[model samples]
Target: NGKEIPYDPSALRKIREHPCYSENASHKFGRMHLAVAPDCNIQCNYCIRDFDCVNENRPGVCSSVLSPEEAIVLVREVMSKDSYVKVIGSDIFPISHPSGTIVKSKDSYIKVIGIAGPGDPLANDVTFETLRMLKEEFPVPLKCLSTNGLMLPEYIDLLDEYGVSNITVTCNAIDPAIGEKIYSYVEWEGEKLHGRKAAERLLAQQMKGIEMAVEHKMAVKINTVLIPGINDHHVVDVAKKMGEMGVYTFNIIPVIPLYKFADIIPPTLSDKKAMHDACAPFVRQMRHCERCRADAIGKLGKDVQEEIYRNRGSL
Candidate 1:
């Protein structure tokens, strides 16, 4: 029996090693997120930075922050312990540098180097510096970043320059009115903006930044938090626009009731499925997102941050 399955080479290449982007690779590939960035430029109602627990899986939650050097060491340690942690390239296994430092190769275990925040990666200068250092030192792995999109427009060029091919922007609402209810405030150029004005500004920046990322040929994924009464109804609209902008995927995550939106109920499974069905025709829907922690490590659903932290002797 012979059957030919047509495939887009570029698309296949894009999702080959990134587990977050490819459902198939999710079981085979692992990712390491460096919590180097600790400052956020915007505030979403569903986010609570004060809560930190090993069981909690959400943005803005990380066990600890590490310097660029420490982050590199952590990656090396993880790869040294596991052979499956692979980065991009043809070489198999990591080699030691002349200075006794571990040099990562194409065949290492950690395939992806992601900067996914204890906060928005673009908001902190440390994030750029860390990425630059990683780019210079370990150029084999796939570099990825996630942000709130407030500062994304200004940094899109820099990110592309640094060889960052994958970007995730959390866009809870396409409409400013709905966004206003979701985001408490946004700090732009050092000024605090509140209410509808803040939401409008954030939405504009998110859309513009997404457009720029798509123009740069970056694999863009929009993360929409589905708060039942807030932006649930507006997700289809967001997906439609994202499709128009050529975004690769849309991750519609059910809102975790917390912080300012504690009283609001999370969307039921049926409701979530209904939204995905509605938006299925517009863009690719991500049904497997774990709403991972900022310091999340290892495979998609089975996180190994605890083991890594224990082996490293600290949080």
Candidate 2:
């Protein structure tokens, strides 16, 4: 798995620094995901945002949505590793000291600032505002965004302009028929489409967007939700196509099984491993995805929410 880095020296350097892309770096470098975007353009059947910040660890969920200004302030605090008493919107974080005082240390420093929203970032205008503000205040941390790629092509320039070099796109299927089964609907240019139409439109944009991001020399990563009856069998195809497009990494995340797809059984660890192994031959595979929340902070295993909330009494 370590042998297939398709990127040039510069891109490989960025990948090595990224916590999510590089398993070895995750233990040392930390990343913070700001939940600033709350509106999505594409509705995947397996995704549900009914519970935004509910102490659950998963994607499409957050403690709260912050404005551009608030996001900047949060990033500043995280980078400074200051003692945060209480923060905005649901007391955003419980940091540093016990009794809700955040302990600041070198270990808690956030190296990467990203927005993997409770919704699609490209669909929300505040994403740009937040990125612009972050770029101004925090110039060091690598910037990234997670999206369904519905609006990727439209916002690629904006993302690049704001120093966003890392991108993760959730593409469940390369085939429209299979995609239709995974997504309920998609919105393009103020038009709402469903079924095969929505699937095809989203797929076309995903391919084009990945190609554009690659051509721009941005480190592109593909995140595929392995739906057993839906696209599990086709994830390898997804990886192969994305590899041909020059994507840097492929992460086959097991479906969380929620919303319209709730009744479906979640993929077993073995199933994930099988898919992971199958896709490894095509592109570099990521093995350390925590399915992080939109407001996640700290390293891969020591995130703020998981550390503070899950182990509050002990701390």
lDDT of 2 by residue, 73-149 (tens): 66665566333322323233445434544333352345578888777888889999999888887777889888888
The 10-residue segment with the lowest total lDDT in model 2: 83-92
| Model 2 spans with C-alpha error above 4 angstroms | 1-13, 52-62, 81-104, 306-315
Provide TM-scores for the models: 0.86, 0.86
Model 1 scores worst on lDDT over the 10 consecutive residues at 90-99
Q: Per-residue lDDT of 1-315 in model 1, one digit per residue for the tens?
A: 588877453465456788878887676677788888777788888877663211124645445888878887877677564333333242222222133333443334457889987877888898888888888877878898888899889999999888898899888888898999988999987799999999999999999999999998888888887888787778899999999999888887887788888899788888888999999999988887877777778777666676557655674
RMSD of each: 6.8, 6.3
User: On a 0 to 1 TM-score scale, where does candidate 1 land against the true structure?
Assistant: 0.86
lDDT of 1 at 152: 89
